[model samples]
Target chain A: MDTAVLAGEIMQRSGAETYRVEDTMSHIMRKSHATRIETSAFTTMLLVSLQEEGRQPLTVVRRVHKRGMNLDRIVHVNEISRKLCGDSLSLEEAYAELKAIEQESQKLYRPITYQAATLLTVIGFAVFFGGTWLDIIGGGIVGAVLVGINLLGKKLRFNNVFQDISASIGIALMGIILKQYVFWNMNLETVIISGIMPLVPGIAITNAVRDTLMGDYLSGAARILEAFMQAAAVAVGIGVGIVIASALIGEKVLL
Target chain B: MILKIIGVFIAIVAYSVIIETPRRFLWLSGLVSAVGGAVFVVCNEAWRMDMVLASFWSALGIALLSHIFARAFRAPVTLFLVAGILPTVPGAGMYRTVYYLILGDASMSSFYLTQTLEVAGVIALAIFLMDSVSRIFLKRDVGTQPWTKERNMDKKQEEK
Candidate 1:
């Protein structure tokens, strides 16, 4: 029962779909010779129960906070669960592995590497959008600004929607400055769009679709609404940035 | 076109890193995204298809390939599908919708709003169709796998 809840918590925190978490938890509990097992997962909570013939029913509820995209952790947990269910791993070993995965302190990439990757991603998006050399360079610069904003937000403990809005505002301001002052002919659309790609709710929307198809309507609706809210936040931030820039620059520079 | 596809692959790989995908599967995710981007490029640029249609085709291609790769690699399907489908997601449409709204053009805003919903809907449809199709095959494959055979027998015994 403990292992099942731990596994479910890690999977949910790592942003696995609701059904996957439920399925994994129930599967793990079944291995304990329980006559009945029940698992339920929502976007932010997990409940699992196990009942044996002559023993009291055991139940666990874990509230998950601070969700992020960490496919590496999800893959690790999936592998451990698979091995455990396949009878290749002992329960103690499986519990140990789950604990390690939950408390992993090692960073996957260096700070500099993460910043550079963000730069590269935005630059690549600019190129994919058919940007010229100037646009790519401008996009990279805006991407760097975004990275800086994110780091600062982390230090300040900004909430998720606030983080996204601040990042989009930074992208918009940087794009305008680059186009107006640094690169005279750079395409603002390319730079702004590419820079905002990192802040998009693509993964969230996709996950919502997957969850809904898996017959988990509660989390699915929550996620879909979450995605739209994030998108609106980004859009509103950009709009504010544009208005601020125009007022400061003494012209309506953008529509 | 080649340049754009390469760019999409690079972006996808970098995005996967940002999301902390396992190192071993980074290239696989990149490959999947590039293929989907290629399809969108061909359908949109070469054939002048509508953006909604292009995105649907791209998402369908990504979903199919991600399912195949997930089965082949024994990894969760979302590990590949989430990042791979990034390029086709309707971020631009959503942006445009709000952009026009802020500009006080209610008509254009509504138009893009509908377009964004359509694109999102088609993408969901594509994923749903592929998921159902893949599950049928996945069931047969898992039933035959030796590792799951024991579990299957246990289930059968429980039923009896």
Candidate 2:
């Protein structure tokens, strides 16, 4: 609830060096102590931080804070703890910071649900290289449908399983458009790659790999498995459409 | 040739940075990606090393650079991993894959499989090896996280 307590939670999640936690705590303490800042409050602070810092890369700031070995602003933060904290503070640790924010009991924009639907429709056209009116209109519809689902999930407070399933199905439906409408000219690979861009396992896999390298074997393995599952889910979404197309055409769906 | 390698490396690094990777290893990953491709190409063409060996060496080089970058940056291995591996995605090979698929040449099936797997393998290899090795020398100094002692203590109890 207080700054020190808040600092610990941050440390646990972000794996920041002790000093970094203390610095954040001190900063927050100097500012607010209501256990969690409102979304607007946090965003306001972040904007101020960003503006004052002149748009530096987030990671650069982190790295500088990391090398400050003289940084432990608290006790019981012996060398071992300090080392672990340092280990956790890496860029991969960025996730930890995010986790902290999410746990703040206060959140940002309401997932911008409608925005997602709009994005999907726009992306659909981008996938198709649309110059024709039909192309633009179709992409808009798809995007709208996609965003509709995103909003639906938020409204219903759907769990991860439900979200994943709907997203997968939504993607397949788009694939149907790719097939039935565009047919022979659909640029299947590009469509698949671009549509599944959000599902790309780059970040998860990289983190898993990093965790393992850092000797956090248990965490690493868990993360790697998580990454694979995410990727497999993406593949399945595409594979289903491919299989369906193959069945309809009596030819192996090479996409 | 040198510029090409550097260009690829720069591309990979730029991608990572734009997507919000840690700055500490951005340059390092870029260097690795560029150099890794160059090394493979050079070894394959000039030294006449077996293609497999040349690629292996390249992967090894990139992986090593990635690992060291991870350590120095006090970040995770992926910043380095993506930066190191993206350059080697085998766009050319994939082009060939598409061509062969369109051409319906069954023999090129293995070629497609081989090249596709190679690219994936390089990426996997970089991440897997980097993950495995990063553990040996992990740093944990996070800059901003919910790191209050009481909160972590409570979390430990919940986990148990």
Worst 10 residues of 2 chain B by lDDT: B138-147
How would you encode candidate 1's per-residue C-alpha lDDT over A1-255 as one tens digit per residue?
Answer: 888899999989888888888877877776777788889999988888888999999888888987988898888888888788778999999999999888887768777877888888898899888999999999889988998998999899999999988888888888888788889899887788898888888888889999999889999999999888888888888887777787777565664
Tens-digit per-residue lDDT, B57-149, candidate 2: 777777777667655554434445554654444333443453354447757955865765565556667556644554444434232123344
Q: Model 1 chain B, poorest ten-residue lDDT window?
A: B141-150
Candidate 1 wrongly placed segments (more than 4 Å): B143-153, B156-160
All candidates: DockQ = 0.63, 0.09
Q: Give the poorly placed runs of model 2, Cα more than 4 Å off.
A: A1-148, A158-162, A182-184, A243-255, B1-120, B127-160
Q: Best candidate per lDDT, number?
A: 1
Report the Cα lDDT for residue A179, model 1.
81
Clash count of each predicted structure: 0, 44
> Per-model i-RMS in Å?
2.1, 11.0
